[model samples]
Target: MATKKLRRSAMLGRVVAATATLGLVAGLAACGSDSTSSNPTTDSPTASDISGELNILVSSADASDKAFGEVVDAFNAKYPNAKATLNSVPNDTYPTTKSAQLTAGKVDIFVVKTFREMPDYAVDSTSEDVQLAQSGGLLDLTDEAFMKNYTPSVLDSQAIGGRQFAVPTGNSYVTGLYYNKKIFADNGIEAPTTWTELQSAVSTLEGAGVTAFGIGGKDTWPAGLVMNGVVGGLYPTAADKQALTDSLWDQSASLDSGVPLEVLQKTQWVFDHAQKNFSGAGYDDMPAAFANGDFAILPDGTWNQPTIDTAVAGAFEYGYIPFPASDNAADNKYLNGKIELQLGVSAATKNKDAALAFLDLFSSKDVYTKFVATSGFSSAQPDIEQSEFLNSITDITSQFEPVWESIWIANANAGDAAAYPFNYPALKPLGSDDAAAAAAAANSAWTAAF
Candidate 1:
């Protein structure tokens, strides 16, 4: 596990550095959706011609990323005057492409990799990027009835100062433990409530010739994702260690400043416990192994649920559980999630009302139901019923809200340089056994400096 972690950590740096040194980095990485129907409205005196084409951009490596086409299709059904076109972009280049489009005013409606595209996404005020979007006159939904459809945290992601720049399309991706129900039951093992219990469960599975945890070291994000669970499990209160999650536009306290090194150090234990072959696995590989009952537990994201369910095809009984926090059952569950896959209206959109109308359609109960059911993701709107995946994910999110809120506050103060490492990249080396000493040294350095 330690070796795997080291390899993964090195791989991530190499990838980033390689992209940098080679000047191979380009903008706009993502696939666009297919053409959908354009619903043209009756000619209006007040608004721009309703029959003109509307451009909607979806980002991803795969041109057919699901929501883009479906959205266009739905929109075109009613607005015959509007036709939708998909623009596929690579993930790595998305930031550049999006920026260029914004500058050239070539985009009417498009998606941006908010987290990656924004340099100081979690912090920094007066960032030209955010300001540009705001200046473009974002479709303000503050007073719109659809505002009721989203959760506050979801909305908060797009909100700068008092105004919102985008509409939330989905909630954050949650990372936790997904276990095989039959494996636990057959072994007479209960779902672990503490790190110790979790270890015991893993040990039981390993003794029976199954991998204890199905981990993916490839697609580096999952490495961070799983580690988040481990870190959260160790420091249930770590969420609050950060004072702000909206630091990008504010001058706030350091999110990592107050956290004890001991909390961050617990990741060492998680590193020691991970499966031995983690280095060999990729994101897609884990669910395939889980379905085969090769592992008893997997630390991945809620987004993986759809794939997991499909892989198992109902042959196996599986359950999603919050990662345990140390050995204390009384300690609150800690959850790690991301605010990716959100939606924002084009600031330049001439059809503010129509754009908002489309956003409202996204938040509609029917859309929420369909999206969650199909995507295996959760929703932000509190009123929406919890799908099976949401039921599990939300339980953990609610359990750890206090921790996240604190982090939000701290990040708000510390900005990017401070907040990002506390949440990501910082814990990468801790999972490596060989790097245990290095991890300790890094932890001490961060703690002392923080």
Candidate 2:
């Protein structure tokens, strides 16, 4: 119920904005053929009828390749004549490359960060999906049978103008504190459920000469995750969260007042209590440090499960919990649930039948299960069970509220500026003056974007 409430409210602003943009684009692209069909049979092609070389563009992450490769292998078995090859690109360059490939009609299938990148290409006027359908740049799989297999809420979150443009591959519940269970046990410390308890734990850990938290502050984005998790706990409603975000751009709120000040204070606390030289640490170092028992907690996402497992090599136990933001447990109920990846068919592709077939196969329970399990992420498809590692976090994730990063700023570029502000690196020491200055710089950048 908490998850549903959070999702519904958090997604409203983006969805409404996208829907409006889509409407405007639809009006302008009236001459374009409407490729979006609500009729399931129109887009559904049987495996036997599908035959072609399908090229899929995706990020070059190892997990992505492994999971996609497995799906391709299974898909080949179903339709031997249909060959799907993955074209891997660097993660940082995906948006630019994907946009170029889509515009040139060179890519058949591609991965999207769902509401973020896909909407940009889908619509015509820098708007949303309806224009995408009207422009004939994206396929409408609203009535597609494979969609029935996914959780309705998860699928709907990716929808624009009441149409499904992509199918979600995996869900990530980030912004959790992964603690060294052995260290906690040795110190007789339980996972903190409230802000006061979390502070107490940090004090105890620090007094024991154990690092309270290990942060990849040099990477900057990790700092954003910490802020998001804290915001979830501090803000009780989606509107409350959105108000704070809007203030960053609109200048309605100041860094020294309300949520902004609170966030700065909390960030200051984490920085004050984190391991020495945390600001000098890199992203890769955090997992190793935590696994080696150098720290009691590491703030990160569910995606790190495999990395930690590999680092620890079964030497110690660890578990994740939502970052506590408030003294009241009721207010501290949320997790950073994000749809990490979504598979979409290019609207300009000539191989529509093959693309449709691949989508169907990819969304099938069997294929999707293997992909999610291999990636060490929770399955967005309700019928497919999450991996054992993900199951361990069910205590937090089951009742988790969606993170602001996923809902408010799904676009990678916008997210970078909105989530990881400029001058955030300089604010590491957490002075009120420095935090205020950083917030001002970030707000200016956001305003310029608009």
Instruction: Name the candidate that leads on TM-score.
Output: 2
Report the C-alpha displacement of residue 192, candidate 1, in angstroms.
2.3
Q: What is the lDDT of residue 248 in candidate 2?
A: 51
Q: How far is candidate 1 from the true structure (C-alpha RMSD, Å)?
A: 8.4
lDDT of 2 by residue, 159-203 (tens): 666778788777887668888999998888998999999988888
Tell me the lDDT of candidate 1.
0.53
Error of 2 at 9 (Å): 30
Which tens-of-lDDT digit does each residue in 1-450 have in candidate 1?
111122324334433433442211112111111111122222222323345555565567331366556666766676666565556577667656765664454566666333212325423323333443344433444666667667775565456656555555655445467888988899889988886787777678768777676667655556555545544655455323332233322424323333333344444445445667565568778778888877777876666677788898999788877678567765536465555455555555545445554565566787666665554455666656666666755656653232232233222222232333343344444233333343444334333432
The residue pairs found clashing in candidate 2 are 122-132
Provide the RMSD of all predictions against the true structure, rounded to 1 decimal.
8.4, 6.5
In candidate 2, clashing pairs total 1
CA lDDT of every candidate:
0.53, 0.67
- Residue 34 lDDT, candidate 1, scale 0-100: 18
Candidate 1 regions exceeding 4 Å error are 1-51, 61-64, 81-88, 115-129, 133-137, 203-211, 218-221, 234-241, 244-265, 326-334, 374-376, 383-394, 397-436, 443-450
Shift of residue 436 alpha carbon in model 2, Å: 5.3
